[model samples]
Target: MPRSRLVFWLFFAPVLLWLLLLIVLPHLDLLTMSFRGENDYGEMGWTLQNYRNFFTEPVYWLTFVRTALYALITTFITFLLAMPVAFYISKLARSRVRGALMILLLLPFWVSELVRVYGWMILLRESGVLNFVMLKLGLIDKPVEMLYNDAAMIMGLVYTSMLFMIVPLVSVMESLDDSLIEAAHDLGAGKIAIWRTIILPHCKPGITSGAIVVFMLALGNYLTPNLMGGKNSLWFTEQIYNQFIASFNWNQGSAFGFLLLALSSLIIWAGLKLTGQRLGEVAS
Candidate 1:
């Protein structure tokens, strides 16, 4: 073989193999399992029963919709919070200050996500740190029940997903020309007008990419909802976990998994259509 061809294969072969073996093969197996149902003989038989179950069962369908809505909300919240931080780091701050800010943002992630969720639990649980401090300050007569609720779950989701949104926003915003903003200002364009016309359009790709990633993460997150919201967290992922682990229903779990895959893919496609951005451009 030619030297160039040899080098190309050497670099790309492992990636190709990894994609095929780990991602493609497992998903293919899951796809098959999702369509299979148990027969009278207790053997797997091809059928649409698994998918039908999802539609007919009110709890399952409701949980799925609720999970999607929460994920959407989390993505929006992350985007709102990240934009200003990204703007400051990329456009306003000095280089040293930007670096320090980035380090501070990233430092917490060095700890395991589970550890971070537990840290939230420690602070928010009744009789925990927050309540202790508040009580000591005479703010409340009793400890507040802060954990095991929707608010706590949303807090964890936002905290964990912020970096995903911030990185992409910073990447796109850093490339924006300062001269354009100055020119807009001189032309009597206000901050809102400049943001809508210039900054948002320029950052469309990054916004789409980040929102897609964060939405998917929030949708599929099992640990944060389970740990933070306790038993009341009616997340779709928890249903999947229950099917696979608690109920030992692999076929049902696989069906739920594929539904999540479809949900993420459909939402991403719709977002790209609405924003007039191509998948390749956003991915890059």
Candidate 2:
């Protein structure tokens, strides 16, 4: 082989091996496990029983649907909150201020995600800092039970996922031409009209990228929902975890894992179709 070809192979071989060893092979094993089933005597073999259980079990399918909906809600809320912040950092702030804001945004990410979730637990629990502050300010008569609830779970999801949304939005929005906004203003276009016609259209790729990421993360999250929402969370990932660890049913866990993979793929495909974006463009 030529030197260039040999060099190419040298660099690509590790990546190819990593993908096969870490991703493709494990997924193939899981795919097999998902389709297989065990007899009453505990003998495992090929069957569709695992998949069927997901549909037949109200606890399983209902939690799946609830998790999907919550994930969607988290993605939307993250986008709404991140958009303004990204806009300030990328478009409105001075260079020094932008740097400072970016540092602030990045600070939380330096810590482990598990630690961040625990921090939220400390702040949102009934006797936590937030309730103490509220009591001190005389805003409430007593400490509110803020933890182990849907609101707390959602807040944790949004807090953890917001940076994913903000980074992409800032990347796209920063590239937007300031001249276009000035021109629109000169033409007497209203702020909302300018935003609708100019800003959003230009940022569709970023929006799609960010939403896909945040949605997938929220959907697959177990720790935040489990720790913050307690037993009532019932997130599908928690179900998968229980099946694999607590119940020692790898087949069911594998099936649920594949279902989540399918869900993410379907949602992403639908979003790309609705937005008229090609996968290649979004990937780039």
Candidate 3:
């Protein structure tokens, strides 16, 4: 064998093995499990009941739709919040300030996601820090219930997903030429026009990539929605968890998992199509 071919295999083999073992195999197992169910004789056989249940059951389908909608909303909100920060860090900030700001963005992630969600709980709970401060400042008559709601869940999702959006945006935006914006401004283009004509067009790939990632994370998230939204979360992942753990129905869980995977893939495809970007372009 050639030396280059040997080196290629040496590098590629581990990645190929990792994907096969960790991703491809597990998904295949789940796919098989999703099709297994009891027949009239009470023997497990190939069946579509698991997938059918998702559509026939109102709770199941409704939760799935709700989760997708929330994920989309979370992605859009994260994009809006990340864009300005990415612009500042990439285009405007000095080296020292940029580094400091990046560190701040990354600092939360150094802690486990569970810890960060609990931190939000500490701030948002009725007897937590925010209410105490508000009471002290005479801002409210009593401690307001802030935790365990849709708004709280959305906030937690956005908080966790922000860094994902910002990193991609900043990465792509850094490559944008400042001279383009300068030339546009020099030609009497407004700030909005500069952003519309230059910055946004330049950042389409990053935006699409970030949005896809954020949507997937938010859609599949269990901890933040479960903890922050409490009993009222109603997230599809919670349903999947219930099916697997709480109900001890692995087949149902597998079906739900595949449904989620399908939904993520479909949305990502649609987003790329809408933005006139390909998966390869976004990934690059």
Please tell me which predicted candidate would have the highest lDDT against the true structure.
3
Taking all chains together, each candidate's TM-score versus the true structure is 0.93, 0.94, 0.94
The model with the greatest TM-score is 2
> What lDDT score is found at residue 116 in candidate 1?
92
Q: Positional deviation of 152 in candidate 2, in angstroms? A: 0.9
Q: Write the per-residue lDDT of candidate 3 for residues 1-284, one digit (tens) a residue.
A: 45688899999999999999999999999999999988899999999999999999999999999999999999999999999999999999998999999999999977899999999999999999999999999999999999999999999999998898999999999999889999999999999999999999999889989998899899989999999986856999999999999999999999999999999999999999899888887777
| lDDT for 256 (candidate 1) | 98
Candidate 2 residue-wise lDDT, 101-203, digit = tens? 9989999978898999999888988999999999999999988989999988999999998998998899999999999999999999999999899999999
Question: Residue-wise lDDT of candidate 1 within 161-234, one digit each (tens)?
Answer: 88889989999999999999999999999999999999999998899999988998999899999998867569
Pairs of colliding residues, candidate 3: none
Task: Please report, as a residue range, the 10-residue window in candidate 3 with the lowest summed lDDT.
Answer: 1-10
Per-model lDDT: 0.93, 0.92, 0.93
RMSD of each: 1.9, 1.7, 1.9
Ranking of all predicted structures according to TM-score, beginning with the best and ending with the worst:
2, 3, 1
